[model samples]
Target: MSKKKKIAILGCGWVGNALKTKMEEQGHEVNCLCRDINMDSLVGFYNCDALIIAVPPSDEYLDVIEDVYFSVSLNEAINTQMILLSSLSFYDNDKLIADAEELAKIKDENTVILRLGELMGYDRIAGENTAGKMTNDSTTNYVHRDDVIGVIEIIIDKNVRNKIFNVVAPIQSTKKEIFTQNSKKFNFKEPSFSNIIDKNNSYSSDILCDVLGYKFQKENVQDFWS
Candidate 1:
């Protein structure tokens, strides 16, 4: 565990909120940037040891960073390390990937971007959304919430900067495959998958583990489905 330090998370939705609690349990102080725009949380962001941008990318994507620096970019204390929680949505679209890379460059060494895959863990599998989302051959990436927490913690500890890490499971499996294998555990019928698999957008998160020397506990989607 790292020394206790102030960690300001910009968005405190499901993932971020869970991360805050996990970090705090490990002894780090975390504060969510909620409604208090004028508070020191955002205005004096540099005061914190780390800042995490957990919002999803949208039309207002640029405004997120703009608003953060609108008040205190000029301050000498604006050297706090930042982590941007991005998604693998950048992979399928070349232009989207280019735009995300361009946007990350603006922050330079102070920013660390993580392109996460579909997050699965804590009974988030085999639900309403999983039964009919993809084909048998539609391979997709996924990352456990535990792995996400571990990656963020290590990045902060190692002071990883000016980098983009792909956070995902080592194996890419389709929804049909996932459900077919785990249907018995859930007492549900197995989903039939096609012999065809979508290979275009398939990704491997092996690089993060290789670079950071971290092991993923959630190797199979079936592990978290129950």
Candidate 2:
């Protein structure tokens, strides 16, 4: 019988833990790297084949680089392929990731950088104001955690080489839409949005689907919440 492909998950906090559980269930050897590895007894168990970096975004580029470095160090057993869970914020107006992008380019081969948008699952967007949530003015790109990790699995299965892939749902929603629908679902008052509000927007799942044949599971956020 063929052995299972090993996959490592770094920063197993929220999304990382979910990815680890999903990946392992498919019979892939899973290794999880965490900030508090000592506290968690299950640190260095499996022979990891691909390293999935599930850390969140930060304003500081150096911190991103540091986290990536730490993730790379954890894979001593295999020539672990690197998957950096970067953000669409990298493509923002400020371009805060200029330094990080340069670093990523240097080690492009055998690495896949997933530039995901605002993730919508659990506490990530739970606190948004449901009442008076603004919808039309500001637009945000969101993806379910399942879709995001699914894209990662595709990248691994296809042996997707060095490149950036945006793993987002097809539909875009404004804060008003999200909060208003959420409020209605929970039997609360409708939410509203302000004219001054600005949100990040992008095309969803095209590169992953059209190019890599990966499908995004979350079609819309409204379905997930409402």
Candidate 3:
């Protein structure tokens, strides 16, 4: 039997809440902390076996990290492994990319940073959400919510650390192709694409899979709607 762990998630939002439920189902004790909750609650939380920072990128996120670092430092006996949830969208913004770089420097040897691809699962269908808002010419770099949770569980179970991995599906499909499929399958409106090409590169999950020997449950973004 796998050893039970006490895990603390810093954000109880969509992704975080789902992860909490999964961990609980696996028999791990989980403590969820959100911005609305008292910060004092974190004092004891810092002593957990692992900490998953699922808070989205923002000034408030930085503040949360600063507080966590300070509290962790104070407790010399604490060796809580940290798993920072980042995103591939950061590549589109210089500031977000810089912020991700800065985060990698924190507890460098102990922190495992996961730069996830565009999240797609449940009600968050790439085709449906991107319809009428943007062009569908660029390649998609989506990762299912199940994969995200699975990767985290693998990391904690194997005690993986000091690594940076892109948590995206190995398959790359054009937005237009995915949208067209969704439109036929779900009766969604077909989205238009711009003639202007997107130069952004597609993200690869090779390192994540190669190292963890993990196989994505939902590898095709086109099938994400189902």
List the candidate 2 regions with Cα displacement exceeding 4 Å.
1-3, 35-47, 58-77, 94-96, 123-136, 197-200
Better of 1 and 3 by TM-score: 3
Worst 10 residues of 1 by lDDT: 127-136
lDDT of 2: 0.67
Q: Rank the candidates by TM-score, best first.
A: 3, 1, 2
Tens digits of lDDT, candidate 1, 1-226: 7678778887888789898998898898887885455675445544677778787667766667656544334455656677888888777674644565566567555578899888877766653344544444566577888889889988888878877888987766666656676666666555566678656476777788888898877776556654
In model 3, where do residues sit more than 4 Å from their true spots? 36-43, 90-93, 132-136
Error of 2 at 88 (Å): 0.8
What would the per-residue lDDT of candidate 2 be over residues 1-226, giving only the tens digit for each residue?
2357877676787788888887777788777655554432244532356777676546654565565555455555556667878777777744555556556656545567887777777655532544444444466677888788788877777767777878778876666666666665666667554567665556666767888877667788766654
Q: List TM-score per model, in order.
A: 0.84, 0.79, 0.90
Candidate 2 has a TM-score of 0.79
Candidate 3, 151: how far from true, in Å? 0.3
Which ranges in model 1 have alpha carbons more than 4 Å from their true place?
Answer: 40-46, 69-75, 94-101, 130-136, 187-196
lDDT of each: 0.72, 0.67, 0.80
